[model samples]
Target: MGLAVIDKSLFRFDGVRQRMGLLALLSLLQALCIVGQAHGLARGLVEIWKLHAVSTLVGPAIEFLAFYALRHFCDVAKQRISSKYGKYVAGQIRPQLQEKIFRLGPQALASRGTGSTVTMLIDGLDQVKSYIEILLPKMTDMMIISLVILVGVWWQDWVSGLILLLMYPLIIFFMVILGLAARDRSNKQYAQFNILNTKFVDSILGLPTLKMLGVDKEYEGEIYSVSERFRKRTIDVLKVAMTSTFALDWFTTLGIAIMAVFLGLRLVNGTMPLFPAMFALIMAPDYFLPVRQFGDNYHATLDGKNALHDIMSFIDSPETPQDTETKWEGWKADSELKLEGIDFAYPVGSKPAGDDTQSVASHSVAMNAVEQQRENEDDKKSDDSSESKDDSKTDSKSRRHRGRGKKDAKPIEADADGKAVAAQALTQPDALHHVSMDFKGYGKIAVIGKSGAGKSTLVNLLAGFNTPHAGSIELDGNRLENFNVAAWQRHISYIPQTPYIFSGSIADNIRFYVSDASNDDVNAAAHEAGLDEWLGELTDGLDTLIGEGNRGISGGQAQRIALARVLLDKSREVLLFDEPTAHLDIETEYDLKKTLLPIMENHLVILATHRLHWLANVDQVLVLDEGQVVESGTPKELIGAGGPLDHLIGEMGGNQIDQYLN
Candidate 1:
């Protein structure tokens, strides 16, 4: 909090600059009204019978416009600040978060679910606008308002102003107490709602695998449990919020009652003038107006503060050095690449990737998804093993047993805390630990690892999504930190295992990785990635709409489109593949490898794969175990060593040896 307060003080953050400017103008108008009206009314009341009540019209006009302008200013300021600061906070936080997640690499991304992060980043960040724009500005406005209120009261009558000001400390004190109570309940409600969001995201992502396993019915139970908890907590928050409204109503009623008593006593004795006393009575309730709303709006502000808490949590999160440059004008200018001794551990209790409950739940769902995939692989392995054994030894009943095992062993893991905990491990499962290596951008290299290996993390790091914890990673020999994040992004032609598509035409997606790409360039890229064959079949060709999230495209088609995007980005000096052939059939994989190799040969091609046979044709192979590079050399050299490759090959069986050598 001390740090946060200090940071805020230093920032001069212009979240509500435009609105503040407007608010200042509005405050000036109000000040003139408050100052002018009091004198106008006083003068008119004194000389009323002499000049036909001229002060009545002038004084009322000032009062009406003063109130109107003051309220309007506050309203506009709140809205404007909310919009601007909300966007400002989102824009700054999103990329940093995405980059953080990206750094965790494929292993990290895959271990988590997507739905939660998407929902949190989209909706959760927005809820915080009340604080970033409204409460923060209002807090400042309150200070100035208090000063103005005291000054106006003093000008009218030092005695009345002193009485109001002296008594206000108690009112402010009670308000603070009310605010504290509201904040406590509101924070709990916010935390529970986030949990519910995480659970919902988990439910959605795991729906497919759950359906396959005939456990779809269970989702309702899970969702219901979360919803019930959320609903109850929301009610609790609302009850506390309403408590403030009660206090406000009471204060207004009591304040007016007190004014009546004071006026009655003063009027009977003729100790005070009629107009001044009346004006003071009217202004008494006005003193507590902001307080009334403060009590009611305090809960909203509490929500805002929680949202701010989440955002600040992200910004304050320990960051791996960021790769912010969009275009690496000239990396490796000193040397091609360099890496120092690397050692890293997950930062504990730290938001490893600044992912909220949504992202964490998404990860949980994604991990659960792995269960189905693993089951399938195990089944295939069993089938192949059974087939290789003599036909006489085969039990037809065994196939059903194998299918059941696959069903039970499904790929994705659903225990929410399981993935959350796993994601926190910097070196969980097959992550690299103390190993380090570097190379220039002129050649292709393969990073090979089986299921739990950190190949994906390594890929993300090279792709500039992450920062190394202990060792320095450099591009073109310049320290990674010194590199601009946005600029370095331009250095890679990236092709994901599962491709992404926008809700636009086929042409739009292909052109995503390139700017102002001509028809010829698009067509050329499509053929290079072998997407033209599919395009030739489409009547609309490049203009065909792909729908949101690639709704219309088959999995293979999506991968192919992604490949075409890789080709289109001629500006990128490096190409990265994360199990590019992981999903393709052998025949298709072979064809893709055949086409992909040549295009990537001239650039830096870093491939992370589990398929051993593919390495036979590659120039270099990097074998990962835990999180370290256990073995790295030419594939031939490693195969001769009878090391990690031999182990992976032995598990794959003899067919790989013969097929790969041939």
Candidate 2:
């Protein structure tokens, strides 16, 4: 908290500093009163205290402005600082954290607990707000008070001043030892908290699955265990803190005892004047009081340190530099895109650079099984020679065809359409191989690939969320590197997989990007997104409140609301949709897309989706294998290739292409 306060607070010659100086002056006068009494100058000290106390009282009123400066002006400074820089330093940091898991891609998510990640992102980060805002300010105040203490003690009695100065190291030494043990415990607690949060979120998200698996609800037990563990560890942290404070208190008592002993000897031997000695000894502890309080307040700083470890570690994880001089231009306009030797891989050295298409070996058995079933009937008919021969000819044709030999399979290149894209990267992963691509004449383009194929990476590039290494991606002839980030963003709308709902009405949510958009304009956008129907169902209609997380709304409804928001952004050239309807039902998905297509005309709509059925009408479909584009064309053209994509379509569609076509 102390560090953050120092980092954020602009200490100036102005209000807060001046106010602190006044407060210290008041303390100094009080010190003089004690000294004057000890030295038999009581009448003079009394006159000084009366004269100073009035100004001391008024000093705090003037200091209020400085406190306001700390709170509000500091926020303004952050804005001014970021504007000279690119915005989204905070927003960009989060995606890097989530996307790191993404670059580790499917494997990371699969192995790690989802509930834990959710806790870190949502609750854990939120918890840090207090430490940053409140505790930090208090810490600064404490430090100032400590300085006042040292000054007051030094002026009155050099020996006592020396003792006050020595108090900090003695206190801090013990606190440091306690802090070391506390930090280890804090780390363990954070890990446990993540696990508990992960479990809770998973239990909620997959409740149906859990119930289906006949798992008796163990939430109470789980909560109890988590609470108990957190309580134990939190207590340990607090105990160390309290113990440190008590140690500081003990030293403070000893210092007072030493001062009393020295003062008693001086008085008895008449080496020191009685009033002066009495006043100085009494004021000595008061001088060092703030030091004790500082030691007591050390826990706030410790908590803040831990919070920083999490915040800074996660925020700095992105490979995207906020202020890179590098610029990109001349790539895709809308859905038109081109790739020139673009290769990307996970930061780690586990996977080879390849397209997202599946391997032939992966689908061969299933294709052969279907072929054998088709050929079985004719094999028993001795009289059906021509039919059997025709079947044999068909079989040979099927075998000759590459890929899983499944109906309408594009190729092995579409191993599968994986989730997560560059748009989602809060930070780019380290060592992202020289990824480069070019796209032009963009439109309703379908971005498809298997899990971990870098679909999200592509979307982020298009959205200008990240800059590729050793390569360039352009939108509307302006490479991501060259586009006016603010203006280009204004012209491009993005609907993320996880849509955010502000604390306002549905109208506010839709008009979030366009602050001045009229209610009618908001309604029109809702209509285009197929949210009109849902809005009409509510009494508030467009004004319906959408609490955080869209608490009462269905997932599909929330998705539609997000789509409505993009429409309201009034983007001219492009709209990036990251799984707009992944959580929607087929009926809602069909109706929503049906309404959405016309509005998407003229503007490029690049969507990443796992379900290829809704993607049939897209202008161009790029099937990625790992990180390379191995097969790309219209749905028909790709299916004609007959490989990874086709086999996947068959298996994913229950082995019948017609299953989804309807």
Candidate 2 lDDT over 1-662, as tens digits, reads 23422323223112435433544444444333333333333323443555756545444444434443443443344334323221223244356566564433322332234554455566544544433333433443345545654565566566666765776677657656766666666565665555555445545654553454444254546557766876787787777777777777787788778777877887689876554454556556655565565556555544544544554554434333232333433224434444443322222211111111111111112222333444565463221111010001123222222222122211112111211223222122221232334445656778776533456656655555433333444444444432225555556776766576756888887777788998788878888888766766899787777777678788778877777777777544677777777667788788777877887777777887767775567877776544455567666666635766776566566244443333
- Best-matching candidate per lDDT: 1
Q: Ten-residue segment with the worst summed lDDT in candidate 1?
A: 385-394
| TM-score of candidate 1 against the unseen true structure | 0.67
Question: What's the lDDT for residue 264 in model 2?
Answer: 87
Q: What tens digits encode model 1's per-residue C-alpha lDDT throughout 1-662?
A: 11121124213345445655565555545544544555455445555644666646676566656655666665565567556765786677666655555554433333233443454555656755445555544544454555675677666555556666766666666667766666666666766666666666656755765777666676678678777976887887777767667766775666556656766787689887666665565566556555565555666666665665554554444433443543357433233766555533232322322223332321343233344445565674322211100001112223342222111211222134333433453322213355568776477788886654567666665665434444555665345542226666667766666665777988888897676899999999888888877888999998998876669987677777787787887767767787777767888788777777778766777888887766767778888765667788876677746788778667666334654543
Candidate no. 2 TM-score = 0.61
Cα RMSD, model 2: 13.2
